[model samples]
Target: MATAKDVAARAGTSTAVVSYVFNNGPRGVAPETRERVLRAAAELSYRPNALARALSFGRTLSVGLIVPDIANRFFGELARALEEVAAERGNILLIGDSSQRVEREHEHIAAFVERRVDSVVVVSVSDDPDLSAFADAGIPVVALHPLSESVNASSISIDYRAAAASATRHLLEHGYRSIALFNGPTESAGSRQHRDGFMDAVRDLAPGAAVEEHSTQIARAHAAQVALDMLARPSRPRAVYCATDEQAYGVLFACHRLGLRVPDDVAVTGFDGTEHSAYSYPPLTTVRQPIPEMAERAIALLAAGEERVRETVDFTLAVRESCGRHGTDVAS
Candidate 1:
């Protein structure tokens, strides 16, 4: 392996000068000297030791991300958007998938802290995740979900309750009297917001209408199974509002299996309008999170080096074929 000493010799400079060039310095090197050292390092295929550099500069120029499940299309799209923003700022992004496990979330937090990543963006599995470890280590963090006020970290998220209400209200406007809410597992922060918004809309629109709540895991397959059973019932809902596009797709599949026509027999609205949502069989009507804008703003906030600011972005509802709407109209 090529060493810093070899590059220093090749550049005709002291090892300390090479260190200053690579670490961006406690002391400045002349621009010409910096260029010479960089050229020599490149020619020699010399890479700075990340550990040594971190010890000197206290930054890895990298951001750590922890998502509950990367395979989920929403998280995958979020990761891609965050990566683009991070890259534009000359930072590398390291992703850790928790796979819906709290232990794994903690493990990733520990790993990122130990590795001294400059900042982190986390979408935690738990409603109130323990992030004091990162705080103690002086790592800046931004949660992409509603966090407890006591947690004392920056958060960037849409108003889930309001967004859910807008989606459900759209269904009500279409005169779907029998509506059901297919939400995430019970007792979750996200699930509760979705359910509350859904019920609030239904109560205001049709006081005596049949409204029910169904819980399922965020996975499409599991939600599909649950929806199949639910739709098989004679009292199945005429319209459904889902907390996520994944679950809405599952319901769509169930409708297909039962030979039911969408927006004719059943209308469905989904949240988290990923690109794939538009490509579904009936072209879903869903709530569109400003993911790219949110990702850019989150990275900017973390990079700003100011810890006191928290930001919340707005969401929009995309009306399309599935919810008895023909054109793509946005409601904010």
Candidate 2:
């Protein structure tokens, strides 16, 4: 609870001198004076008022991050990476979990704009999220998903279509013709990209392949229930490609409940290769999204300025126990 005045009083200096010393300021303080102020601050355990400073400078020195689900491991890891990167660049990260609600996401947008965060990084619950709040407030934003060209915001993401193709091709090359796609609950731009990529792979590989598709919420529980119903069908897919690692885990659980063994019975591939994916009952075969790199680039773009950048990072197919290493020997 030590204030600048307390530190200044202890250091035998004016509050302005203390402020100058703390902020490294508009006016220079003598080295000896600075040393005394530092010693006094240390003695009193003084901390500068961040809000006051932000008010003075017209910047909060913070970035706002909005994700649909923070409980999901992918977003959790991304938030951690972005926090680290922001700290490295002398800024703080404010995380907002929309919990898959458009209203909640809009609430976060308004909140961040009201607080005057330097910039924002968004992974919207809806593909066509209204970013006009940030735009109207002149707050720069970068979306971490595939956004439509009409939205006035920067974006950075991997090619979901290509990544989807890679996962599907792995199954096809392994001779699993009856493949299925377990996609997100809604037909979003992101989901569409995934679907398009999946269909592209299936069609290119097998001229007349019949692929089944199912949609569910990204949560493991919802996906689990959905998978349980689907996998019980007599004509269930030979291999299933999931839109997310969370959904894949649900399918894995469903297979277990139905007394089915992975690869031997039903092959599974997941997208968003989060770290925990490797620790699944049978390590997952997935498309490894470059999370850390994506976080870094997104933060960098926001920090540098919002210049309407569109970028695609690389994605790799991580073949492991779940998908069964069939035709290819690649692993990660």
Candidate 3:
């Protein structure tokens, strides 16, 4: 059977347009586009049974999820956890990967709204995404990160600033003075929190510790490249605090290639504790945002139909071989 994506391809338009032509109304399709969609649907024998059911029951039974990069292990884990939880609730998850592009993010936003998914979960590329379309469509939304109070949506996220600070403090207690912060590429809400938290630790713990910051695309390869350049410098910091485990892996890779030992030469800590963190060359110390717990709460919040529910979850610092045998896990 032809799927909406198939019809979209045949029509030379987006799945959203096919949805608009089939579901009608949340938005209008241009006459030419509508003709193309109809012709494509008939030729492909496309039937939107889901849309029909949604209309009949007044609920889509599907939830839309938007993430910056689906391939990133953190987001990949998040998607999988969300899928499992949503499945238990009798709703399927429709995921859209924004490829870390604002325009691509916009496309997914429009597509989700047009398809009239019952609700949405966003791990947006932007710090402050435009939730107006979802708001106008009356679809409930829950952001996995903090959001401005002005936005008409709920948020469920770990306290990133505190998480970062805790990780940095752990590194300081390890007696590494000069530390570098490997942060996300953009200076958004997340990056700002990471920066502030890192500085907070430096100011209070190490006092005059040497610190520097570098930004990279949230990918291992990009992070490796950045790490190589930064670590190649003669005065490279003795320890590094990475915003994500993926980046920490890159730093580890750089250390290997540069003949630097893990804690002996350059200690490191990471955030977003994907399972891979435990098995890295030197097991990584990281701040773990509880994925399963977060997913359960997010799904329950959407199911409850609460207008706006802002919630925070605890993050655990997994002390492992990477930051020098801190063996105990700390939760906050």
Candidate 4:
């Protein structure tokens, strides 16, 4: 409970000088006096009130980030990239995990607004999240997922449909006669795009090949459980394309438990190509999202004083061991 008064007393300065030093204010202090004040504050364990400073200065020099699930690898990577960018810009990043709950997302949003964060980045659970609160508070927000046009926030995301189709087309190129789509459970805008791209690829491959759809939560354990049951059946798919790396890893585990060799007995592809995908038992073939680039763009957009604009980035398909060789050999 040490206050600025105690530090000012120890530093032989008035509280006004301490305030000016802490807030970097209208009045300038000599370097020696600033060092003395900082040393006294450190010795006395004195802390300044962030709220009062923000109320006066209109910025906390911080950015808030709300993600659906911080445990998910894709969001984890995004958070890390954003942190790096924020640090370079002399801003701190505060992470808030919604844990896939809309109420929790709202709670974080309200808290960030009350705390007066300079801006926010969110990956909301709902397709149409309540962004008006932040908009009213004049806090800029950027979403990392597909958002509706009416959401009134800047968005930076890769074309999920095209990425899904590209990965599916890669599977088709391998001539996997029976392909499966392991997609997200909810039929949100993102999931719909994934389905659209997947179906587009299937239709282009045409009537000769068979396609099936499977749904699971975006977690490794859940996806593994679902994949295990599906792969246990006699008519299991020859190749599976998962919407996320977590689901893809789960499918890989299911293949191992079922004694089905990957890219031999059954091939698999994954989206959201995180770094860990390369280290999976068999390096996975996945659609690589430009995470660093996306992070930079999203932060820049949120920092910029411009009208809301939605932008879509491109994704790259990383062909690897799990998708099998790219030769003319047809899948069994």
Q: What's the lDDT for all of these models?
A: 0.88, 0.88, 0.90, 0.88
Clashing pairs in 4: none
- Estimate, for each residue in 1-332, the C-alpha lDDT of model 3 and write its tens digit: 99989999988999888888887856899999999999999998888886565776699899899998898999999999999999998899999999988899899999999988999999887777888899899899999988878888999999999999999999999889999999987744488889989999999999889999998888888989999999999999999999988889999999999999998899999999998898998999999999999999998998989989878899999999888875988889
Q: Give the alpha carbon lDDT tens digit for every residue of 289-332 in model 2.
A: 88888989988888788578888888888778888763333432
**Which stretches in model 1 have alpha-carbon errors above 4 Å?**
23-39
Each model's number of backbone clashes?
0, 0, 0, 0
* C-alpha lDDT of residue 128 in model 1: 80
Off by over 4 Å in 2: 326-332
Clashing pairs in 2: none
Tens-place lDDT digits, model 1, residues 1-332: 89999999999999999988887887999999999999999999999887667666667889999998899999999999999999998788999999888899999999999988999999988778899998999999998878878886889989888898899989998988999899886745577778878888888888888988888888888888988998999998999999999999999999999998998989999989899998998999999999998899889899987775656688989899998968666656
Best by lDDT: 3
lDDT of 4 by residue, 196-295 (tens): 9999988888557888888888888989999999899999999999989999999999999999999898899988889999899899988888999999
**Model 1: lowest-lDDT 10 consecutive positions:** 50-59
Q: List where candidate 4 sits over 4 angstroms from the true fold.
A: 10-12, 29-47, 326-332
RMSD of each: 2.0, 2.0, 9.4, 3.6
